[model samples]
Target: MGNLLGSWRFKEPSTVEECDSTWGSDSEDDEPAVEDDSGVSDSVSPERERAAGDSSPQLAEPRDSLPKMKRSFYAARDLYKYRHSYPNYRKSRQPNEYRNLCFYLNKIPLVPDGIYIEEILTKWRGDYDKLEHNHTYIQWLFPLREQGLNFYAHELTQDEIKEFQSTREAKRRFLAAYSIMLDFYGIKLLDKSGNVARASNWQERFQHLNESQHNYLRITRILKSLGELGYEAFKAPLVRLFLEESLCHNTLPNMQHSVLEYFVYTIRLPATRRQLLRYARQHYRPAHAFLWGPPPKRRGGGGAEGSVGAGSSGIRAPAPTPEPQRRAEESSPTASSGIIVSSHDAMMCQELGGEGLKSSAGLGSSMSRLEGALMMAGARGEMNDYSEIVPL
Candidate 1:
């Protein structure tokens, strides 16, 4: 015991004045762990080593050529070993550690405000104005497993996904929330068929889409949340409807860039992405190039011909696969089964696609007008400034 004490010269705990330079942002709770590990170093000068008659030291000593300055005691510790031991790391790494877990998973509220998942849906029942005006509740309604605008809210968990997929009641409420949001955007959710179309009140909603700048971002989040929560079949029809409104109806003019660039691409499932890309190509007018960015390069049939190719330029092209079903859930955590474009949409593409191009007789003038529209879209603040990767 005496030799153990003597071998390493342990110093007295330094005063706050002495530690002012060494101490950092580490919380008070962390001090106990550091002291318990007792990982502090006993760095000494060569003169002290000579005074103690010590010929060897375990750690490499500071080189004599370097200027002798006081080393930070905190710096001398093996920081990386306990780097993840911090409280935030602890909570984020094992989210379930807290007794208060996600309401979707554990039926408990993890955050302080503590609103029940069902209560929010109940409040917004058939009330489009409340749904339209309230922005904070959207993140709660679509709880993703990432940072969102509502910093106080907890993210959805894997267990939440697994649980949410199983619970009919939770899904019912979730579907209700989705329905209200769809109504707010002038789209109608056919709950029986699990499909959506432009709502009866679409004219007003369409006008709202024209005026509201932030709804596109919200739509991106809504698609990502739907993908995350396993409503695999629901994303595409809404996008296709928006696309049709832009292309055939000549309404929603500003949304063409968003629908093609962000909306279709945010669907994490590869098959869904391919289906939408193929559908877009079928009705793709040459004027679209000047509107949205250029189309994805057409490739040979080895991979799915419609496969969007990703490059260093930031286009997320999932590699083409001949067998669409090969992209199993395990291969892509967020991929799910769905058809974005409806059968009616396909028939419409067959009928009106040719007529629209025939109507667009002067290709040269159309491209020029579309080019002006593109510039005006940028001026209108609808450019693709936010290229998000909606991760699992």
Candidate 2:
């Protein structure tokens, strides 16, 4: 039968003694001793001799005399061997290791020509993806996508890019919010100590704090994180605090002007005003002892005490003094005190004119009869003139 695995022919082999000495036995001892032209033995070690013998044909003269191979096949072999030992080496290698391997491999001409073309293309695509992903991620995190892109493209230094790339989303959001807050407050985030803290993992760190504490920590963390992101941390906190206090209601009397300003600012929001009024109405009480104020009396009829009158000067006449006997008849301190109304309520009254008088009756019926009478007069069209009732 024909040879199945191609033409198989065995030729007579040359004797060991007749074989060319260049391809020597694969043994250290088989290496010939280095000799001068006269065949005198030299003191070179067997390893050195083997290297010298192997290199002789390719490179004339001693290896030490020539430039060391800028790169060596042996080094490449060692790398391949090392990489094989680790399971994950086939995946992405650590940056430094990959760089070294790439540098070494690039110097070797033994690889097929243009072999690196495909590798370079692959790497370029990966880098592009990485940059694109980073761009998209930053845009998702902040409305300042264009700004961030500019910063990364032209403003960011190499170190900054490294930091941004290494930073996680939580950290990035904290930084962005913190920077915006600082801009709001006009404060810097960094301190003289240089012990910058990052907001990246802040939520996890202070998750156990109470609501108030959590808010405080969150603001502070945002500031610190901004610092880590190379912004002014101090300013961010100050701005955030200002905004928070201005918009939020602070019951603390001793709170600073900055904090109060922030609270007031926040209160300006429609939602915030609604909440403030809702809360204030629930807890607020007037200092006056009267359960209800008297109905506003008519300008001319009976000229009852506590009656308000419209005047030419636009000022309303004050309530008349009660007769001594009548005062004695109803002298409860609660009855004597004027009705208390919130600024909001007073504004409503002024806006509604005479209709506001009816509102007073429904305010609370437990008020004194004297106060009720005043409220009824104001309700019954006698004091339709809103010019008399001062807006709170």
Candidate 3:
């Protein structure tokens, strides 16, 4: 009985000095010891053990902090590269307020005397036949009636005037209907007359434009008006419009001609062919490379300049093909073959290198191991090796 009592004796509790030396004075009073019926002692208290876990230094910092630090480091490195590589890069980095000022300045239309007169002439050329033969055309004309009379008269002949009136009236009706359709889609177009308008249910009208003329006039109007907000602001509205219409599903046949004509006729801006290219890249898909897929050759004696009559007439002739071809040939070594290799070429080159080959080999091995594991786990039946798969 004495031997059994000795085995069951409770060990004396350690002194406060011992507890302080082990876990510091702050935890000395907080920690409490425990003993079983047999009186075996445990060095750590329950509270001390929990405190040890809660105060781990490893878990002190947040999980997201490291990733944020890495991202900022990369961004700084990219900005340094951009600043050193490009000469005009700093212009783009101007304060947002300064950029807005430049943007607003460009939006002010250059309404010169000549341009104003041209607008009047354009209006007259279309409306003249609609007026009674003796209906005082001069009185109906806007403020600019006296300048460049011969050109205006020559251009607006009796037959031309009739055609123009027919076209103009048709366009007006179409615009009215189109405005209603835009309203259904929650988009409104402000007319030149200061009236906010919407499009009618113009599914048929849209189909006509798509199949017959390939001219989306309402869309063009939206793009042109929004374009006055400058390039960046213009893109978002255009993209949003396209997404709302689900235009991406259908490939636009004659996209270049349709887009350019929309800009020229509806926008009524003298956009050069180069400007058209820029517009396509900025507004359309970044991957869109084809421009009418082989532009037609300009034929005649004096090339583009002579054909267009380049002396302030404001009419630009179509670009001559030979000159474009010559320029293309000079720019590319394989231009004649119509081969264009962009960044995709660089990736292919890297894949053929030693380091890339080694990495690819490792990937192949890991993939094989994964396949084996999947097969063993009954997730797959069999596997075939794809070690020879090319990068590009």
Candidate 4:
């Protein structure tokens, strides 16, 4: 009896049994769990076991990471190129603002100011002093997709475009307003169409634009507005005209970089922009086989000109009295309907996002990257480029 008493020891509290009592009977929805190695009876299901796992933490085993595959440069480029997986789709419209734009287009006076669109286009016509000096009217005559320099004016919306395009009078009035500005720049909007030709008084008007500082900014606004408001047909031709006289003719002197950077880049439509670039690539006439020549230094403080610079600022200058292949009556080389910007020649938009497409040959800069993004905006088929075929 003494030997038996010496061998015996006090039983430790059974924690597993306590745990089973607390958790096991609570799983009313789950099936009963089979007994583990423990001798303690437990009715706890797997779900219940997981819920009460903090009491007896069961850690998961760590996972091994998969090895990354090696790739060739071209292979990687093709694989990771910008796919434009997302789109910029607008959800709402500003009704009051849209109504105001319509009213302005229709020549109806708006509210207390009683300002109609035509008042600015006609009353201010040929007054370069007023046109250049008074900044508020430009926003009204040629509005923008985004806010303009004038804060009081409303920026355009998609609804304005849809509403304006369906109306004939609005389109006609818009073109008329466009014509007035073109005339101011020494270019004439062709009768009954959105096209342009050099005005009869081209030299004087052209000289003012050539001399004035504000015209280029207005030109950018015009291009952006035309695109936003569905007069996209006007954009490519205008850009082409600028490129032809500036880049190809060298008539305008040191404007190669300015036109490439600001004027052509102002376009919102990607297809039109890429078409213009391809035209530039064709007409650039680089002095070296490798490097492009530096842009010429500007004179008269960035604006001064005379004698059509090299040719007419007209929408379609008679093309030096017309070639046998190209008619005198035929539209300018950058006409909207004629040019088909092929998908094969599509742009280096993906390269800008660093997805690594083969880079374009020349003029790489932050400006180029921004233009790439603008190109991507029109990549979707939602909008179409005004396809004026230029007889190459």
Against the hidden true structure, what lDDT does model 3 obtain? 0.28
Residues 1-392 of candidate 1 have per-residue lDDT tens digits of 99975465424334222222111333333233332211111233455423222122311232221111111223112111112121122224354542213454437653555667666656656576766666666676777666566676666656556766777776777777788788788888876555778888999889878767467767866876786677645777778788788766877887865676567655434344445554454444431122222223334422222212111111122232334454453357555454344334543442332112223222121112211121111212112121222221
lDDT of 1 at 383: 24
For model 1, name the residue pairs that clash: 236-340, 310-317
TM-score of 3: 0.21
For model 2, residues 70-171, the per-residue Cα lDDT tens digits are 111222222222112211222332344322122213432112222332233234232423322222222222221112222322122233324454556434
lDDT by residue (tens digit), candidate 4, 299-352: 543212111111111111111222443442245555555644332222222112
Q: Which residue runs does candidate 1 get wrong by more than 4 Å?
A: 1-119, 282-392
Better of 2 and 3 by TM-score: 3
Q: Which stretches of candidate 3 lie over 4 Å from their true place?
A: 1-189, 193-200, 214-256, 261-277, 283-392
- Residue-wise C-alpha lDDT for candidate 3, range 53-135, written one tens digit per residue: 22234323432221110011221222222112211221222233231122122322112222222233234332322221222
Report the Cα lDDT for residue 169, model 3. Answer: 44
C-alpha lDDT values of all predictions: 0.48, 0.27, 0.28, 0.45
Which one is best on lDDT? 1
The residue ranges of model 4 lying beyond 4 angstroms of the native Cα positions read 1-94, 105-114, 191-193, 266-274, 285-392
